[model samples]
Target: MANFTELINKHIIVIGGGAAGFFAAINAAEMHPGIKVTILEKSNKLLAKVRISGGGRCNVTNHCFEINELVKNYPRGSKELKQVFSRFNVSDTIAWFKKRGVDLKTEPDNRMFPDADSSETIIDCFMYQVKKNNIAIKLNEEVLNIIRNPKPETQNPKLEVQTTRESYSADAVICSSGGHNNAKNYNFIQKTGHTISELIPSLFTINLPGNNIKELMGLSVQNATVRVEKTKHQYTGPVLITHWGLSGPAVLKLSAFAAKDFFDRDYNANILINWTGDLNSELVSSELTSWMKEKSLIVNTPLYEIPKRLWAFLVDKADIPDNKPWNELSKKHLNKLAQVLTNDSYNMKGKTTFKEEFVTSGGVNLKEIDFKTMQSKIMPNLYFCGEVLDVDGITGGFNFQNAWSTAFVAASSV
Candidate 1:
C-alpha cells in the first residue's frame, strides 16, 4: 500500500486497444503498482484482431526459441528484432500466458494457439489481467493528436493527448494503433515527429480470376514449390486452389516476403508452380519413364504424390489422350506431361486479404525508435509498437510475437 502512494500521480496513456496496446497497458500497470494506465481505443471493440486471428483461435506466437531464427520470420525488422527478441522471445511468451492460466499449444507448423482453441480463451485472460491490474479502458476515445511539451525546463512536462471526445495528459505515451494500408491514417503519429514507411498490404492470397485453376477449387496440394517468375522470391509448402485464386501457407509466405514487389507490379505477375515438389527435370523425366514402363494405362495410373483429380487435369492440359496406355504415350506426349507436371505456371492479377488478419508491410521507420526500449528517438517518452512499427511477419504467429516483444520492452521501460 505504501508503494501505491508513490505512483498515484503517474499517468500513462496507451493509444489503441489491440494486442500491443493492452499488453503494454497491463504490463506497465503491473510493473508500476498504483500507476494510472489508461487505454484509449479508436474503436468500440477490444482485441478485435485477437478475436478473429487464426479463424478465432488467436495465434499467440510461434514456437521458435532461437533469437536468430525467430527474427528471420519477419520480412522487416529482422536485424532490429534480433536483440529485442533475445530479451523476450517465444519461450517468454508461452510462460507469460501460462502464468496467467492460459495454456497455449503449438501446431505442427509451429503456430501457437490457446489450448482451448478459441480466441476467447486468450481474450478472457487479457481482460482478466487488465481488470486485476486496475487498468482504465476508454472505448470510442480516438486519439486525434499528441502534443508533447517542447520546453523541458518547464516544471511538469506532461504529454497532451487530444481525443475525439475530450483531452487527457500523460507522463508517458504509447502508440500501438496497429497497421494501416492508407498513409493518411498515420497523420496523428506523423504529427508527433515520426516519419512512416510506405504501407502496403501483406500476407494476401493471389487473385487469378478467370484462370483454369479456379476449376480445381477445393483441391489442395500437400507440398508445392511456388516461385514468382523473374524474382528471387519463392516458397515451398501446401498450396490451396481457391475459387478466386491460390492460397495456403506457401502463397501467404510469398505474399509477405514479396509484398512490396507485388505492390510495385500492380499485382500482375506470373507464378511458376512445381506441382510434384520435385523440380529436377531429370528426376521428373526418369519418373515419367518409369511410369511408361509400368505396362498400365497412363491415364488410369496417377504419377507421383499429386492428387488424381489434379493429375487428370494436368494430363488434359498436356493434351494427352485419356485412353492411351504407357506404351502408346509417345515420347513427345510423355515429355509434355512431365513438363506440365513439373512446371505449371499461372498468372496473378490481384490479391485478397487473408481472412480478417490483414497485416501491413510498412509503419513508422525503425530508425526513429530505440528497439531496446521501444521509445521514439525524436520524441522523449513517446513509444511505438506492434504493426505500427514497420515490423511484419509472414503468416503464422510471428506478427503477434512482435507485438508481445515490443510491447513488453516498451512497458518495461515505462
Candidate 2:
C-alpha cells in the first residue's frame, strides 16, 4: 500500500544522529508525510551524548520562559539566537516533548528533565517517532564529500553526498555535523562556501596545581564569588574543590564567558576567590571582632556559615595557633585571619574538560546562514542546526535548549 513514486519525489537528508539531527529528521518527516527522510550518522551509536548528559537524566531544556533573558546564557550566537529562539523557544520545547508523552520536570536551578528522570525515556520517544514516521536511519556512513548540483537556473537545486560506503543524492540537505575541533572535518561544509570559525573549549574547569585547597577535595561553598584577576570576568554561585582544582557552576560559567581570554593566557593566571559571599571587608572585620569578644576560644568557634574544618584550616594557614583565646589574639593575627577569610587567591596552571559536556565555542560562521529559515544565505536548500553553527551555552541545560530551539526551527522551515 506504499506509494513508491510519491516517496521518490522528494528526499531530505539529515547529517548527524545527535539530538539536533534526530529532532530535525523526525519533525521534517512528520510535517511532510510524502517526502522521504533519512538520517546518516558516522558513528554506530545514536544520541550517545544524550545518554551521558545530566548523568543519564537527559536535560531537555531550561525552565526559562522569557525570550530576552534566555539569550543571555549563550556565549556565542547570542544575537543570532535571540531571533531564532523567538520562533521556537523553551515553552515550545516543553510542549513538543509533552505532546509526545514525555513529561519534563524542572529542577530548583531550572534544568528541565523528563519526569521519569531517565535518558532512555527521551531516546525511546525519538525512536518510536522515527519508526512511526518511516524515517530511514543509516549508521557508520561517514560522509567524505558533498557536491552541489551546478544548475543555478533550475527550479530546484539538488545535492550529492558521498560516503565511505555509498552515495546518496537529495533535493535538500541539513548539516548538523557537530562541533569538531579538527579543521579538516569541515572540508565538506567548506565546499559549500561556508567559513569556519576558530574553535575553542568552553564550559571547562580550571586546574590549580600545588594548592593545598585540594586537601579539601569534596568541600563545597554554596555561594562564593570568583574573579579572574586583571579582567572584568566574575561569577557567584556554588564552588566545589576537586582533587585537581575547582569545579562547579560558578567556575564553569566564568570559564565559558572568558574562554578566549583563558586560552590567550595559556591557562596561567591568578584567580581571587571570596570565600564569604559578601565581600564587605568592614562588615567582616566587625563580625570577627564580635565573635572574638563573645567566644572564649577563637579557634574552637568558627564564625559565619563556613564549615568548621575549612575554617580551622584557614585559621591555621593564617598563623593562628590552637587553643588561642580571643582576648589573647594579636592585632596582626586578627587582620591576617580576616584577610585570609575573605580574600583567598589561587594559581591556575591549566584547565580540564567539564566532564562529558565538552562544548566548543566556534563553528560555521553565523553570517552565512539565514536566521529566519536556518538556510544558507549563499546556497539554497542547504540548512544548519545545533553546535555545527557558531553557538554554545554555559552549563545548567542551556546548551541543550539551544539545540532544541535551532533544530525545531530548521525542521519546520525545511
Candidate 3:
C-alpha cells in the first residue's frame, strides 16, 4: 500500500464521460487535491445521458431517504446496494450538488431534478466542476484495453490504459463506462479477465402492434395494476398509453423486473391490466352493484375515478351498449363489466426503449465487486461503478441514484 506522501502525485484515470464517469472524476479530484485525474470518453459528447435524462430535466437522484426503501427501487443489485447506499446515498448526492451551487427540486413522484428544470443545468455544473478541479477530459479517445502491471509487495499495482489514440499509465483506474446493449462493446473489459453478465434491456415500453389500444394513445391511467400473464411480475402505478404501447412508471417497472422473462419469451406475451389499482373482480363487482340503482346511462357514470374515455372504452369492451341504463343491466352484462374493469388484457408483441435514456439490466457481475469500496474484487486498483456494473434500477431517477452512489464510492476508494 502506498503511503499518503507517495500518493500525492498519483494519477487516476476514469474511463467513460457519462454520469458515473463525471461524478467519479469530479469527486476523486475534489477529495484528493494533489492527485492528477483524467477522463477518457469514446464519444465526442460529454454527459450525453445527462443532457437528455428526465426528458431534458436530468433527474439527479430520488427523494427516498430510507436506505432499505431506496434499495427496493433497484431490480438488480438490490442486496449489494443496501450497503453501498449507506456510504453515499440520495442525501449525499443532493448535498454534493447543493454545495456546488446546484439546488435540486423533488417532483410529486419523488424524482429529484435541478431547480432549473433543464439538463443543461447538470451539464453546466459538471463542466464547471471539471474546470475548477483542473481535471483533463479527452473526447473521442476510446479505451481499447487496460493492462495491469505487477508490482512489489511494498507498492500498489499500476495500470496501463490503452486508448485508441495513446496509452497512459495511472496509479488507479475507475471504470464508469456506462451500460452497453451490445455484448461486443464490453470486449475491452472482458480481455482483462473480468466476467460480464448477460446484457439485457430494461426500462422499456411494451409494444402492442395491431392492438386497438394504440388508438387511445396519449390516454393515461393514474393508478393501474399491470401484470404479465402466467407470471408473477406485476406493478401498480400510473400507466401511459403511448402510440407505441404502454409506458409510464408502472409499465417501466414491470419491464425492468421482467426483463429476463420478456427476453425469454421473445417479447411476446399477454399483459393484464387492473384499471382499478388494487381492486379485484369481487370488489369491482361489488362496486358495480351499487351503481345499478342509478337510472343514468352506464357510460355516463364512470366508476373508480377512472378517466371518462378509458371507462367508455372498457364499457365498449364489455359489450355494454352506450345507451344502456345501469339499472337495466343483466347479470351477464354486470359480470363482463366487472371482469373488463378489473382485468383488461392486451397482447404485447415487442418493446420500445427510450433511446436517449436507455438502461440495461446487466454488466460486470456484482459478486466480483466490493460495494463498500466499489473496487473490482478480481483486479487490483481497478474499480467499477455506474451502469457498467450489473446494477440497474427502474425509471424515475433510481438509475441515476445508483450511478451517483457507486461513483462516489469508487472515487472515495480510488
Candidate 4:
C-alpha cells in the first residue's frame, strides 16, 4: 500500500460536467500539474446548467456578505454549510470569476451577473479554465455506475465508471452529476452505498387543477408573501401571477422550503397569499378605509395602487357587486374584500419545474463528508462536490456559488 503523498502520480476521474464537475476537474488539475485529470460527461454539452441559469444572464452569486444570511437561503443543510461557507462565499466566488477575466455585476436585488449579461460568459470562463489547465473532457460518456469493493488494488475502493460505450477506472472519483430527481444521477450515486432521501420535484411553480389561477394572469406584486400552511413555511419576495399560476421569487422560494413536505403530502397543499404584503391587519384596514373615504362615490374597480381589473376580480370573488360604490361598503363587505386582498388562499395541487435552474434537495449527506476538503468520509481517495451530494440554493446565483466554493476547497486540498 502506498501513502497519500506517493499516490500523487495517480490519474483522477471526475464524473458529471456541470458546475461542480468542471470546478473539481479544473481545481484538481491546477493543484497537481502532473496528475492527469479527466471529466466524463454523459451529455454532449458541458455546463448545461450554467448555460440556462438566471434566464441566461447567469447569476454568479448573491451580494450578501454575512455567512449567516448566505446559509439561510438553503432550505436543507444550512447549519452544516455555515462552516464551509465561511471559507468560501459570494466574495470568493466574485474574486474567482474576476481573476479569470469574468467580471460580474450586481442587480438591484443583489444577484450578480457577468458583464456580458449572458451565460456565454460563464461557459467561456469555465471552458477557458478547463482548456488552459489541459484537463480532458469526455462528452457523451454517460457514467452508468461505480464499482466499490471492500478490498482492491491500485487505489482501494476503485471506481469502475461505465458508460454506454466503455468503462474506465480512476484513483480518485468525485460525483458532481447533479441530483437524484434525474434517474441517471440516482442510479449513479445509489451504486456507492449512499441512501437518498425521498426525492421529489422542487423549486417549481404551483399548478392548480385546470388552471384555476388563470383568471389572475399577468399580475405581479413586487412585495408579496406566500405561505404553504402544511409546513408553516412562509416566503416573501417578488410575486408574478403567470398564465399557469403563481410564480416568482416568493413562490419559488416557498416551493423549495416546502419541497419535502409537499412531496410527503402527495404534493397536495394550500397556499396563503398576502398579495398587498399587508402584514399588519390594522394598517390594511385603515388604508382600505381611507380609500373608501376618499372615493366614497367611486365604483369603477378600486383604481391605482391595486390594478383595477384585479380589484374587480377580488370584489367579484367577495360577492360584492362590481358596480357598488365604495360608500356603500358594509362592514361585512369590507372584511370580505380585505380577506381576498390581504390573505387570499388557494389550493396547490402539484408542482411544475423551473426549466432554467432546477436543483435537488438531498444527496451524499453532508454528515458523510468533510466540507473542508469535500472528501468522502467512508472512502479514501474519493471526493464529492457540486449538486451530486444534496447541497442546493435558491434561483439567483447561489447554486453557482456552491459549485465554485466547493470546487475551490477540493482543489486546495488535492
Q: Write the per-residue lDDT of candidate 4 for residues 1-414, one digit (tens) a residue.
A: 345466556778888888888878887777776677889988898888788778888888889889988888888778867777887888888887889898989898888999999999988888998889888889888877777553755466666677777877777787787775755557766666666665656688887777545777887777788888756888887888777677899999988888888878787888888877746555666666766654443346563356666666767777888667787787788777777777887887877787645677877777778887888776666677777667778777777777777876776665
TM-score of each: 0.94, 0.93, 0.95, 0.89
On lDDT, the stronger of 1 and 3 is 3
Which whole-number lDDT from 0 to 100 does residue 138 have in model 4?
A: 90
Best candidate according to lDDT: 3
Model 1: per-residue Cα lDDT over 149-249, one tens digit each: 87877764789999999999898899999999889889999998899999988889999988887888999998898889999998888999999999999
> Candidate 4, which ten residues in sequence have the lowest lDDT sum?
295-304
lDDT of candidates 1 onward, in order? 0.89, 0.86, 0.90, 0.77
Per-candidate clashes come to 0, 0, 0, 0
Candidate rank order under TM-score: 3, 1, 2, 4
Model 3: residue 252 alpha-carbon error in angstroms = 1.2
| Colliding pairs, model 1 | none
The superposed Cα distance between candidate 4 and the true structure at residue 353, in angstroms, equals 2.6
After the best TM-score superposition of candidate 1, give how far the Cα of residue 138 lies from its true spot, in angstroms. 1.6
Give the lowest summed-lDDT range of ten residues in model 3. 148-157
> What lDDT, from 0 to 1, does candidate 2 have?
0.86
